[model samples]
Target: MSGLAASERSVRPSSGLSRFAAMFGKELLELVRSLKLIWVPIVFIALGIMQPVTSYYMPVILEKAGNLPDGSVIEIPLPTGAQVMAETLAQFGSLGALVIVLVFMGTVSSERNSGAVSMILVKPVSPASYLVSKWGAMLLLSSLSLLAGYGAAWYYTGFLIEAVAFKAVLSSFLLYELWLLVLLTLTLLLSTALRSAAGAAFAALGAGAVLSLLSNLFPKYAGWLPGALPGFARQAVMGSLEWSSRFGACLVATVMLLAALVLLANILLRRAAAID
Candidate 1:
């Protein structure tokens, strides 16, 4: 305790912002060291590009896939560029979401296990600073990765299929990005509250799956839930949906829900009796 107290006095930030900046920088550095900064975007690009390429070549693939009966014909309609983009995002919501959860599953738990959280807390760090720093780093990586992957898909969709409206693509990307953030936030919440990183990942995925299942069961009533975001993204791509009260309500409600989750995470960390 005496050594910790002495170390705490050795370096104190002038303000809360400085302390947060320090912690945020550390988190970013850790991400780079883990090589997550490189491979995550690459994987997303692979997943993003696969959708358009496969959709464009489905006829050729089908013909060569296997030997059909003597006079077999499989005439399938080629999807538009907008449809392909929506499909790519659906891929993201499934596989991309899983990659993200696994990538960040140990965000806080590892720190706790290594005793870093105890040493850091002995200093002038606030729970908000600590949690926000980790989240901000993860969010930054996610934004960049999503942009690279989605941009590649849009470019290829234009080359192979019809070109989607830039406005619609942009709108869809923003909505999907927020949805991914909500998933990451849920993972962060569990990572902070639980000791097992794998358990945190599974629980977060299960909760999101349940939410999506319920929203599918009750669209009109569940529009305000985060599960509505994926459908909203698809609507943005299809250009069928408009800026209506339902959309507005869902948007505002999602933002509020995101903030509430962060506040709850802060309380959880602050009240935590042990980091390991």
Candidate 2:
């Protein structure tokens, strides 16, 4: 009895929470090692600064692009800070989103292709813990990148143009972050399901594009989709977003879809592991 108790004590398992934290730390360490934690945020900051600077100097640039016909006045009005900020968000939606999806698209697929995922699953970690660790780490990186970029954009916009309201910018940031979470989670889900990183990235980006196209084509009918999040975010920056049933539904739908993607990714990874 004494021997059995000692053996059991010696081999005692780690709590789920401990395993989760360990796994999350491992993911973060991987990000650091890969320099993703550094360069991605830098890219975002550069993107943020570009919008205000480019908008501020557009008239000057055009003036120097060769003399226009005399009296052919290009009376380009300077954009307000909120408009410039909105353009920055649009830049994020396109270029920044592509960068983010591409960076993370390989996370699971590369691990699985190299048998690292199988090795990971062989340990005493639950699939949920493993998947969520990746998910949480990616989310953390996204938050840091977005905040750095948004802050840079806000500062530059205020200096170069009019100052955007604190409340409006904050609201836009929260909404846009939620939208980004939904986007990244979808890419992560595809990465878990597909073995080809490029294929996963392509599919996720295509799906996002389709959703955005549909929302633009049918704004009244499709405003509740996740694609509408950016428009709502733009409205937030412009102080035009309102709390209505439709907006509430869109918010709830995005959250539900996020939860569903995380759950589905966990299930897919488990099924794949079981097959292995």
Top candidate by lDDT: 2
Report lDDT (Cα) of residue 233, candidate 1.
93
| Model 2 lDDT on a 0 to 1 scale | 0.91
Clashing pairs in 2: none
Residue lDDT tens for model 2, 1-276: 999999999789889999899999999999999999999999999999999999999987887885787667687899989999999999999999999989999888899999888899989998889889988988899989999999999999999898999999999999988888887888889999999999999888998888778877897899788888899999999999989887898899999999899899999999988765
Assess the local accuracy of residue 16 in candidate 2 as a C-alpha lDDT between 0 and 100: 93
Q: Which regions of candidate 1 deviate over 4 angstroms?
A: 1-13, 273-276
Alpha-carbon error at 76 in model 1, in Å? 1.5
